[model samples]
Target: MSALAPDPRFVSQAPGPGQRSPFLRRLAHASEPWLYSAPALILIVAVMLVPLVLGISYAFRDVRLLNPFSGGYVGLQHFHELARDKAFWGALKNTLWWTGASVFLQFFLGLFLALLLDKPFYGRGIAQALCFLPWAVPSFLSGLNWAWLFNPVVGPLPHWMVSLGLMSQPENILSDPTLAMWGPIIANVWWGIPFFAITLLAALQSIPRDLYEAAAIDGAGGVQRFFSITLPFLAPTIAITVLLRTVWISNFADLIVVMTSGGPANRTQIVASYIFTQAFKKLDFGYASAVALVLLVLLLAYSMLIVLLRQSLLKKG
Candidate 1:
């Protein structure tokens, strides 16, 4: 009798080189994820990487805004100058306060809004739309509106404050250094709150109703359920949002630059405005670039800290 032929259908397939398993083989060739993200990666490289490289190059050289001169081989000069400059330090301090305070307030306010909106009510859609309107407004243009609204002489807010006997005179919020920082923050927060609210609201909606129902069956109240169940699930989202907002607020220059022009004695100038001033106004192109490099480094450090914190939290869970 002839040798029986093996059935191809039941044959053992040899493992391909570099493939851990058949599952990985499918994943290795999968087009869905890469296709979905290819555009974003290309866009980021073009928009983000190009500017980053330019900024870094300019930091090393004296490239004035007007002249755009290539200031060559300054070596630690700009960094040293930044360390000595009071304006830089002041701007940094204000930036930290602005970013921290605004993020904190935005988080709580967003959490409150998200919680409130999670419960269905009349006109909920309209209310949510109105709440998110500030985000839709152009940030720089919002600065203009806010600047006028905070104007000492004519803003309706100050008038109300005066009428309420909070102050005998309409205070120039943008003129006082302490209040000046707050002016930009108020605008930034208004724009930022809707972002958090929307993000958190989505997360809140995704929570299985069964969890809440089970909690209710266990005699846990809304607050209790939130503390135990809701907070735990939302922690990662909140952390990510806070870190993102920190990065954003730290770099936020629009409101301050537009509204106060880093005035009230450079009290409102963040790293962004400071870099702008160094590059444009002072014409210290290389020095400004160095300051920018420092800011970028600091931002990276901050992001690293957040990553560490996230890792620690994950380990705990």
Candidate 2:
């Protein structure tokens, strides 16, 4: 018998330049990012999303840790309780003050430091490192350190204030209900300023030098150049940084828990710490989850407002 002829249908054609096997290649290309990100996505779902959903469920049901049978559905009972919770209202007010003051101070101070660092000088790198050192310290340690520094018996700050006539005598400001919130606020600002500075400095460095040069050549002075060139360029960064820091600081409870534990008549009890207190100390997980849900809603609203405002401003400009 004659040798079987080569089967034309089974013959393969070599892929030319820019050619590829469509189906498999397209699938791999589409799935490549998901494959690389699956681990992180799974971790986030496990750690964050799952807890969030569970907490929302807990908000509507009794989930006290110490109770043997506390998972009964309660509908809007927890929310109704939250509405009348005087302590929760107080904590909400404190959260606003804490977040506003901390973000304002941190942003301005960071901007100042970033501007200073943006310009070359002696020991510039060292100065940047020193300024950023506080951020490197763990949050708990920073809180404790500041708590110590506010202690009248051990710290010199109160004594120095007395010497400068800023106080009647060496007194622990953290013990004063009126001034207690300032303790955590100051610590937060110090620790957070470096973050804003680093972010702003990076944004500042990315600005084209020629814009400043053009502004200067147009008879613009320092202030004019700043207003006309720098401020406009930095506006987006400032808005985003402020928004993020506001939300983060509003939710932060570590410094308050470490420094004062929301003491002094609960004057420093922001919503976050109050939630922690309800959950951990009182073991009222339902109430704590309710409070957290409220906070989450408020934060979502605030973020949306900021984003809309930014978009509007961008359009107007």
How big is the positional error of residue 115 in model 1, measured in Å on the Cα after superposition? 0.4
Off by over 4 Å in 1: 1-47, 65-70, 305-317
lDDT (CA) per prediction: 0.82, 0.90
State the displacement of the C-alpha of residue 273, model 2, in Å, after optimal TM-score superposition.
0.8
* Local lDDT at 66 for model 1: 61
Clash numbers, per candidate: 6, 0
Query: So what's the TM-score on candidate 2?
Result: 0.88
Q: Model 2: which ten-residue window has the lowest total lDDT?
A: 1-10
Estimated TM-score for each candidate = 0.81, 0.88
* Tens-digit lDDT string for candidate 2 (190-277): 9999999999999899889999888888888999888888888998889877887788889999999999999899999999999999
The reply for model 2, stretches above 4 Å from the true place, is 1-29, 305-317
Best by lDDT: 2
